[model samples]
Target: LFLGLIILIAVWKLSQTFTIMNLGKETSESLGISYSLLEKLALFLVALTTSVTMITVGALPFLGVIVPNLVRKRYGDNLSQTKLMVALVGANLVLACDILSRVLIRPYELSVSLLLGIIGSLVFILLLWRGGQKDAV
Candidate 1:
């Protein structure tokens, strides 16, 4: 649950970063948005969201990482655009994986996290391949 919560928060952060970056630091700063204030707002929101989600859903899968990446890739990485794209893609990915897992092990069930981990590994590999050079890990 904690892990899922973290990922949810991360997704929110990524979305915010992509949006805020385009707005430019200058504009944001000029608006009297202090770094500490923004940071606190973001942190509080993510935490509240994840905590509520965790209690209700026992942690949804693939929402944090997959949605944002899929959005960034398909749509322009603008704040509003990316957020929408990520939400849609994330939902689709989770649904598809859930279906696949059900079919793959008929009577048995698989954890969404486990399936996402496998998919995450593949995604990581693809990212590395597409990246011209590796950064310090």
Candidate 2:
């Protein structure tokens, strides 16, 4: 828990840097951001967080992939603004799936990964469909 908090704080602090980095390497560098260093830092943080999460709660499958995309689709591409919403939505999704898995079969519980996988696949398909429609238009 403490480690997670530390990582969350680190990520929160760097959110603006990340936003600048998203503007492309040359642009961010022109704006006084070290693109390579920030990229390495971001990758390191992601690796550490993923390692910790896996050790703590097993694998969450597509929660990472889907939550941010969903949040971005609704809230645009600003990392600092969307970060909290992503965390909240991801937590709520896992909590809801876990609760449903436990209650859906009475005595027998489904694996949270299984539930997330099914839901994630559907959401991914929907996102793809929406992307295709936008491209077509």
Candidate 3:
């Protein structure tokens, strides 16, 4: 929990910088942000969070990818604004998948990772399809 809190605080502190970083390297540098330093910091934070999560909860395949994409699609591209929503959605998604995995087969449970992988692939395909459609028009 301490580690999680630290990661959360770090993300909160850096969220605005991340938002600026998304605007392209030259733009962010022009805006006085150290692009490389912030990028390294972001990468470190991601590694830390991933390590902590993997150690604590084992693998949660696709949770990281799907949750943020879903949240971003609904909330737009502001990391600061969407981070909390992404966390909440990810938690709820895991909880829901866990419940479904347990209930789907009586006296036997599916792997949560398996469920998430399948769902994530479908959602990813749908997202790509939608993106392609938008580009076509």
Most accurate candidate by lDDT: 2
Candidate 3 lDDT, tens digit per residue, 1-137?
68988998989998989999999999999999999998999999999999999988989988898899889888999999998899899999999989999999958999998998888888878888887987421
User: What lDDT tens digits, residue by residue, belong to model 1 across residues 1-137?
Assistant: 66666766675666655366447667767655565566676777678777877776666654675556556655756765566566677778778878877878889988876787688677766765665464311
Model 3 Cα shift for residue 34 (angstroms): 0.2
Q: Which clashing pairs does model 2 show?
A: none
Pairs in steric clash, model 3: none
User: Sorted on TM-score, highest at the top, how do the candidates line up?
Assistant: 2, 3, 1
Select the stronger candidate by lDDT from 2 and 3: 2
lDDT of 2 by residue, 37-116 (tens): 99999999999999889989999888998899888878999999999899899999999999999999989999999999
Q: How much does candidate 3 score in TM-score?
A: 0.93
Error of 2 at 120 (Å): 0.7
Which regions of candidate 1 deviate over 4 angstroms?
Answer: 1-18, 21-24, 60-62, 132-137
The runs of at least 3 residues in candidate 2 whose Cα sits more than 4 Å from the true structure, single-residue gaps closed, are 135-137
TM-score of each: 0.70, 0.94, 0.93
Provide C-alpha RMSD values for all models, in order: 5.6, 1.9, 2.0
**Deviation from native of the Cα of residue 53 in model 2, angstroms:** 0.3
Q: What's the number of clashes in each of the models?
A: 0, 0, 0
